[model samples]
Target: MPTITLSVKDENFAGKVLQEVLIGFHSETVTIRDIIEARVLQEVEAYNQKQPQYFNGLVQPADAEKTVNGYQLRNKVVIDPEKQVYVALDAFQKNGFFVLVDTLQCSSLNDKVRLHADTRISFIKLTPLVGG
Candidate 1:
């Protein structure tokens, strides 16, 4: 019924889980955790291109210690397979622009879905109200 897409700067990584994550929307409840897990798996696979086993379980401190795309991943990251929804918001202070990821609509575990590679994102607009 609904579709979910994950767009990444890395084309190869996004292609890995594009089908799986899109298929998760067939049901009524989509879990963002699963989607994130799939992405992480892709990242791990990319990191361990020589050995596939490096991405099997939770990423330990030693795993996070490595660098990826010039960025260092921290051990504080948690991979929870049981989590179902994700609400993410990003704001650009300089440009006054914001984006929100609606985990409820774009999850694969909930309805018929599709995945795409696009940089454009949609978000709801909210205005702060003054209250005493």
Candidate 2:
């Protein structure tokens, strides 16, 4: 299948998109696991190229501080895509965040998602309420 570019965003519970990027997928159909992996890889590659102090991806890195834009690593180091993918997958499984393919909510890591040229995917991180 021809590669398709889709819009990916990190959103908040208030429906505000904090960050956005366009990613190209080689296939139109992919599992949630695949999506996380690809997205992580792209984010890592971009960060690696720039060697930025903040990592703006699906999940935070080890010993990193969570900032408004992204995670601020303790040191300026190259992020491993595999580690990020692993953490992201675990986060999804543990309800740390949720994924939405267009308007459809994903239920499983193995769940299949259909992509279109205009499809938009959102990753919303779940923040715990301060007060009980």
Candidate 3:
């Protein structure tokens, strides 16, 4: 059994990384859903420990106010990882954002993603332009 380390990054259309984290998985092959869950869980765990006012996660938590960099909660509280994961999966299905597995765009949550140590996964969130 070997652990594969993948670089998960959040980037914009211009190819700038907003946040980056290295995640490890033992399975060589996983579904897009697995990747999303892992990323969200990791972020939530970190936030829970600190109970920060700002949450920099894959998906915005319910009741959070979206800020320029991340979401700002009304008060510091432990975030629910399950809820965030559910919201993220729904967002992916609704085209709220997109996942890129080393240049290949993921189409479905069940899409099989092959893992490699050097794999670069990028998540680009789509924001509707104001009054466009």
Candidate 4:
């Protein structure tokens, strides 16, 4: 079993550390999409287990708003995990965010790459200018 650290960051490069996940690799390579899906699924499971009334996901959960800490606590866990994953992948494809594997930028979901014990994966979310 190999483990990887998943992190989310903003434009200024500040990051939020996510949990490390143990993954099984058939060999020494896996697709980017596979990695993303695994991450999203793990997040969803954690959120579900915590049983938060609201779900704090890669993006804001539906019908929920951010709090002072920027997390939404909903009274009902009513969001689709699969849909959330799809939205994230779509966002990646549209440049809504970027993936950095071990400090190297990954450009495609289908791109295959090798994993290492110390590999740190970062999701850098880009924000758009209000006036632009």
Listed per model in order, the count of residue pairs whose N, CA or C atoms clash below 3 Å is: 11, 0, 0, 2
Q: Give, for candidate 2, the lowest lDDT window spanning 10 residues.
A: 123-132
- Extract clashing residue pairs from model 2: none
- Please give the lDDT score for candidate 1: 0.30
Best prediction by TM-score: 3
In model 4, residue pairs whose N, Cα or C atoms come closer than 3 Å (at least 3 residues apart or on different chains), thus clashing, are: 53-74, 54-74
What are the per-residue Cα lDDT tens digits for candidate 1 across 36-130?
44544554445445433222322222333333323233433433322211211111221122222333223233233233444222322222111
lDDT of 4 by residue, 1-132 (tens): 444443433333665664234444444577778777776676677777776654444555565666645446445564567876787788778887787888788999999878766666676767421100
Span of 10 residues, lowest total lDDT, candidate 1? 84-93
RMSD of each: 11.9, 4.4, 4.1, 5.0
The positional error of residue 31 in candidate 3, measured at the CA in angstroms, is 0.8
Best of the two (1, 4) by lDDT:
4
Give the TM-score (vs. native) of candidate 4.
Answer: 0.73
Estimate the TM-score of every prediction.
0.29, 0.89, 0.90, 0.73
- Across 1-132, the per-residue lDDT of candidate 2 in tens digits comes to 438888889889898998998787899899998888888888888998997867777767776788776788778887777777777888788888899998788979999988888887998889521100
lDDT winner between 1 and 2, please give it.
Answer: 2
Alpha-carbon shift of residue 122 in model 4 (angstroms):
0.7
| lDDT for each residue of candidate 3 in 74-128, tens digit (9 for 90 to 100) | 7777787888888888888889889999999999999998897778899998952
Winner on lDDT between 2 and 4 is 2
